[model samples]
Target: MRRVIVIPARLSSTRLKEKPLTIIVDKPLIRWVVEGCLKTGEEVILATDSERIADTVKDLNVKVVYTPSELPSGSDRVAYALRDERVDHVINYQGDEPFVYTEDIKRLFKALEDFPVATLACRDTEFYKDPASVKVVIAEDGTALYFSRSSIPFMKLHSDLYPLKHVGIYAFRKEVLLEFTSWGQGHLERLESLEQLRLLEKGLKIKVLLTDNYYHGVDTEDDVKVVSERLLKKLSNPTTNW
Candidate 1:
């Protein structure tokens, strides 16, 4: 299937302003995300509403699609950007995930052959209590049952349960993406403030793939420092498996 990666970047951020242009280890945060996607050698496009963000990546050898500023979410911006494209699949690689692994991206692509939508998740227990860390519960067949900002499957009595941290990376069939954008906000989605729930509410299946690779997404100033240090280490050790 023909596939392409689309990154949604916006200048306005509630926690960190001008997030895409924020400097992380001498390079813009968006630049690092774009570069990581580039390692896959797939066509990459940046979807944004700001001309300033467009100019920042002008020399990156990637296409920049200008979207409207009123788009509600990054997923909406991505759908608008690929409206006229002929791609069969679109990977919504969030601009904030600078530490996204190319291998995990490829795995997500492969997963789309069997499922219409797929995402990456890694095992983690430390961040389960943190609402910012989304959690996913999967069925026996590897299909996601639910995605929540709150800690799921309350370990009220069990100590062996560990939560899966949902990675922001997603691969969507072109038609599915369009259909998702057309549907109104779901009750669960609106309440949880998690967009993926809208799909589940619509009876669409989302496959979850467990990955060993760890991804760091920058949402606050403290995240910036953490990502910067990890980025420096990755650059220094090119052979390091993520």
Candidate 2:
């Protein structure tokens, strides 16, 4: 199936203003995200509402699609940007995910063949208590049951369950994406402040691909520092294993 990756970038971030343009380790945060997506060898596009962000990646060898600044969510921006495209699948990759793994993206793409939508998750105990890290619970067949900013499947006693941190990246079939955008905001989605919950509330099945790779998204000034240190470490040691 024909597939393309779209990174939605907005300038007026509530947490950190101009987050996409924020410099991290000598490179713009959006550039790092775009470069990471490009590593998957898929056609990657940047969908943005800001001219500054669009111009930032002008020479990055990737196409930039402009959408209205009033779009409610990243998914809406992506749908609007690719409204006329004939592509079979669209990957709504968040512009702040600088550490997104190419292999994890590939896995999500493959999973899309069996399900209309697919996303990535990683098992990490440290993030269980951290509400900033979204968690997901999956069914036996790998279909996601729920996504929440709080820890799920609360272990009252000793158990083998580990919190699966939901990665922000998403892959959607073109038709499903269009349908999703058409649906109005869901109650659960608004309550949790999580867009993916809208899909679940609508009874749409989303396949969750378990991966080992963790992503560090740039949300605030502190996040920039954390990502910068990670990038610097990688650059300093080329052979350093992840």
Candidate 3:
């Protein structure tokens, strides 16, 4: 099946100002995201509301589309971009997420063979209390039961595996994405301020893929500092050792 990566970026961020255009190392943050997706050798389309954000990746081998600045969320932006394209599967790669692993991208697309929606998660208890970090609880079959910004499962029992830190990356079948964007926001989604909950509220199963790979998105000044260090390591290294 035909697969692609669509990155949604906007300059008007609530937390960080001009997040997409923020420079990390020598290149813009959006450029880092685009280049990593390009390294996967898959077709990448950058959906953005800013011409300046679109201009940063102009020399790269990727397609850029302009969407309305009023678009609600990144997923909506991705869906809007793919409206004219003939794509079967797509990964809504967030622009702030600079770290991209080709193997993880492949796994998410491969999961579309069985699931309508799939996303990545990893074991991390550190962010359990951090409202900025979303947590997911999965059923026995590896399907997500719920996604929340609050601490889940209550941790009454001692275990190292309960709270799973949800990575923002998502892969969706094209039709599923179209329908997802069309649906109205749900109560839980509004409460948590997470878009993915809208899907769960609609009774659509979301497959959760767990990985040990380090994935982080830039959202604050501290994130920029931390991500810059790691990104530099990745770019400076000739091999994939970072």
Which pairs clash (backbone N, Cα, C closer than 3 Å) in model 3? none
Cα lDDT of model 2 by residue, 106-207, tens digit: 887888888999988888887788888899999999899999988786967755656788888899999999999999889999998999988999999999
Residue-level lDDT of model 3, residues 123-147, one tens digit each, is: 8888899999999999998999999
Candidate 1 residues lying further than 4 Å off, grouped into runs, are 156-161
Cα deviation of 173 in candidate 1 (Å)?
Answer: 0.4
Q: List the residue pairs that clash in candidate 2.
A: none
Output the lDDT of residue 177, model 3: 99
Write down the lDDT that model 2 would get.
0.87
The 0-to-1 C-alpha lDDT of every candidate, in the order given, reads 0.89, 0.87, 0.93
Tens-place lDDT per residue, model 1, 156-212, is: 775443588999888999999999999999999999999999999999899999988
Tell me how far the alpha carbon of residue 100 in candidate 3 is from the true structure, in angstroms, after superposition. Answer: 0.2
lDDT agreement of model 1 with the native:
0.89
Winning candidate number (lDDT): 3
Model 1: how far residue 32 lies from native, Å:
0.3
TM-score of each: 0.95, 0.96, 0.96
